[model samples]
Target: MAESGAPTQRESMADRIYQALKEDIFEFRLIPGDKFSESDIAQRLSASRTPVREALYRLEREGYVDVLFRSGWQIRQLDFKQIEELYDLRITLERAAMHKICRLDKPPPALRLLNDIWNPDAPSERAFGSTVRALDESFHCELVAAADNDEMTQVHQRITDRLRIVRRLDFTRPDRIDATYREHAEILQALIANNPGEAAEKMTAHIRTSQEAVKGISLERIREVSQQHRRREPGRP
Candidate 1:
């Protein structure tokens, strides 16, 4: 058992490193395109470079980071094409999940949890504030989790995590926040009413709107960056 425990402990350490790295990225403590060497991370975390490298590869597989040959690793910068693909996949996966929930002989109990937070009468806005976006993401995740389809939930989770970097950016504007609140309420109403068609339609429209919102924000940020670069150029207009 000591031999077996040795491998388990190493795996546990690697997982710990992975979770810590993931949180840092999610919270923007380590923003996109930030670079660091495995040695740096290993020293910072008090672990060996091997586990740090293992953690980074796991992140790379999930599209969270990239390995730089002979250099270091970098938190992945936003990729518009990849993000758009994730949104499309979100629509496809979630539409199917919505259909499944509505077709159920009875609504999944998860709806109760959703309703607790999402009922229009609930004061989630006042309480949640900016965190509303996180809860909104959770609402969709919960649906997939409760759908009783293990395969679907696993795939959905991977896609969801991939898009999380930008998903909340959709709610940055006040109007977008209001729209999300209203849209989520409508979708839940359809589910509660057992109207699969309307629910799926609402899901599709919500995701597309969110996709456009993210793209708009990303393009605006890119323009800002380009203008900053031009201002710094030695010869400029």
Candidate 2:
């Protein structure tokens, strides 16, 4: 029992480290191109080197970081061209899903759930900040799932995961937040009405708008956010 429990505890520690590191990346506390050693991370997080290494390998696989040959791990830089290509792929897959969704004999139950969240009757009932960003991700994912293609859904989810860091930056402004609510409501209405053409157009435009917003993000922008974040939490390095 002791031996069995030990591995679980180690795994839990790795998971915690993974979450912490991911938060640092997302909040720009660890800016792109930043490099640090496993020992440094373990010391900063007060964790064991073994778990820190495990967590970093996982982040590397997820495209968040890369291992250097003789040096330490470095945060992955944002590739604008690759990001643009990914956005195009996402649009293609989602547009196809929209057509399939419209052709379904029965409406997907998830549509109702999406409608409730996105098409709320009053502004007072809406979610805010990071919550809205998460919901926005789920909204597109649910639409893909509604098309009833497990393979496509899986691919879409992978793209969504890869895009999350840059994509979430779109929600930082009040105007973007308002646009998201309005655009999501429009897309939801189109989907609910079983109008594939309209839904596809709205989804394409919505994603394009978000893509455009993230394009304005520069290294300086990340540095500014990191400075603000470090100021708020003085302990972060």
- Per model, state how many residue pairs clash: 0, 0
> TM-score, each model?
0.82, 0.84
lDDT of 2 at 44: 92
Model 2 C-alpha lDDT per residue in residues 117-175, reported as the tens digit of each score = 87747788888898988888888998899999999999998788778878866788888
lDDT at position 211, candidate 1: 83
Evaluate model 1: give its lDDT: 0.79
Q: Which ten residues in a row have the lowest lDDT in candidate 2?
A: 1-10
Per-residue lDDT of candidate 1, residues 1-237 (tens digit): 024555434457888899889977665557676789998889888999998888999999988998999988888888878888888888888889888887777888898878877777865544345587778778888888776798998888889887776775567677777787788889889988988789899989988988887776564564454455456653211
lDDT, candidate 1, residue 229?
A: 49
The top-ranked prediction according to lDDT is 2
Candidate 1 lDDT for residue 105: 76
Model 1 alpha-carbon drift over 4 Å, by segment? 1-11, 123-126, 219-237
Would you list the C-alpha lDDT of every candidate in the order shown?
A: 0.79, 0.87
